[model samples]
Target: MKYDLIATSAMGLESIVAKEVRELGYECEVENSRITFKGDELAIARSNMWLRTADRVKIKAGEFKAYTFDELFEKTKAIPWEQFLPENAEFPVSGKSQKSKLFSVSDCQAIVKKAIVERLRSHYKKTSWFEENGPLFKVEVSLVKDVATLTIDTSGSGLHKRGYRVDQGEAPLKETLAAALVMLTNWTPERPFSDPFCGSGTIAIEAALIGQNIAPGFNREFVSESWDWIPSSVWDQARAEAEDLAKYDQPLDIVGSDIDHRMVKISEENAFEAGLGDLVSFKQMRVQDFNPKKDYGVIVSNPPYGERLGDRKAVEQMYKEMGKVLVPFDTWSVYIMTSNENFEKLYGKPATKKRKLFNGFIRTDYYQYWGKRPPRDNR
Candidate 1:
């Protein structure tokens, strides 16, 4: 049962997702916001359980070029939908069109739905209307320059929902994005890691997960788990392997702090729910007061952007304070994500390297200041 799978990611994270796919022993092609790969049923289960930075896993059912409604219908109908969707399946078609002949997204969705229904009806042979009492198969039709790609969503909920963090602070970072921020750094399990502005402790928790080699999806479920096309034994095997591969006994040096006491409490609760109760520490403190005792540490933070006009002056002052406090630790690498255009100027030091990233539609820059690695004898 070889299938084409697509792991969708944030706009700037396609390469990271591709790296994850390749690490899973699958060949992948990296696109703008997705990675297309070849795999079997086990690959599907494994990917859903292990990819920490992907938004969702989908099955690429078919792809073709279609200019007119008739062409769209024919091309969509040509796909073997019966092979995936059972007679009682609840399939809902969604669509998007961009710079294509079929500019109307609703019309495209309706046409695709009709084509799939007709195909299923012909294959099943006794269908007036499908009961749809079974598992859900969400189908999506995307058109770009008149090329249509049909896919079925395998993850009902986005992978960012790791079943933890029932509560969060204002403007909480997505778990997927948090994992990506950790991956962007050069931090490892041996190095101390801290997040000064840890809103709900997403970055610190993600760092702990990385250090322990824990699968982000270990505590979650995916839509494809109930699909008839995939065997339950495959999922069982994948989960068992994930459990065996996890390094629960591995040591980690991670901490998170926030100015708000309530947020600190929320971070503790989330960390406990993530099964990292004793592995990571959380405290309530201002960023300027942060003083790590270790050298060659890594500090990654997503701080206030000062988007409101009234808060601009205060946030600028905070940034200046951060510069003053952080400059003394010349041996610690600092990574900060912020939407402030003048962050470098306010921080009083230019970043060694800067990368453009999006923090939930607010364009931000990741300022990286590489610290010199400690000598081998000290390490």
Candidate 2:
């Protein structure tokens, strides 16, 4: 049976995530917050395996208006818990409320949990024998404008936990956000890509994986495996497809560097774990120390915004340093995602284009600086 699938993405990366879904041969109803599509269990598995920028994959069980606790309990009770969850599993309800009829979110959460527990107890024919403590089964309840919608979390620990970054440096870029930056570059495998302020080497690693067309889930395990109802053959099929899609022969120039030597070491280890050490290079150098060997390539970076690093003066100096390093590459293009517009003054020019992007709670601007390149004259 087809089920409604919701792929959760970061606030600014939603459009790119939706595009990635369409690329995978699925028609999605895209919105500002999330994208909805209809797929079976295999589709759900595929999404969990390949989606790079999504936060989680959810299976829509039921959605209805809940004006009171009784309505919430009754609607949640109707869900067939035995179909997806094992008897030994714990189904914990998690949710949010905003300008809704059920103003008390805690009360709503309790009611929903009670309903699921009631269903599970009835299904197993044991009032108190079923274990309430197992791997968590997440439930999402959204109370928006006084209407309630609910769904089941099929992807646990979020997709950002790519299972490679065991440690992080100061203000390291998130793997999902780094992947989104790589996507915004429109870079093919033919072009060079580099990140200078590559703390923990997230952008560099993500770019290398994309260039080689590696599945992000290759090194990771997923929560979908916990569902006893899905056949083992289906998961095997999905994994086989993932294995076949791995690419090792592509030549790519993906590189990352940081001022910290330890960060460079961490990046190398991460690449090794991802089986991409040979495809990516990590160096210990500051932005000023970098001099490109190639003329035209893509430079995508998330430099320190000075939030936890330093004061405003140091941030301005950092931007100035970036400007100096980039001034000579007329054919090259650069994209900087930061929360500061003072970057314009420091760079001594206005960006050709700016897009609104959010990095968690900090609203950011994605500034595209097109280096001076004379228009080609077609004779």
Top TM-score hit: 1
Worst 10-residue lDDT window for candidate 2 reads 370-379
lDDT tens digits by residue: candidate 1, 26-71: 9999988999999999999999999999999999999999999999
User: In angstroms, how far off is 325's CA in candidate 2?
Assistant: 1.9
lDDT of 2: 0.82
lDDT of each: 0.94, 0.82
Off by over 4 Å in 2: 133-135, 308-310, 371-379
Error of 1 at 332 (Å): 0.6
lDDT of 1: 0.94
Q: How many angstroms is residue 307 displaced in model 2 relative to the true structure, after the best TM-score fit?
A: 2.4
CA shift at 297, candidate 1, in angstroms? 0.7
In Å, residue 310's CA in model 1 sits off its true spot by 1.2
List of clashing residue pairs for candidate 1: none
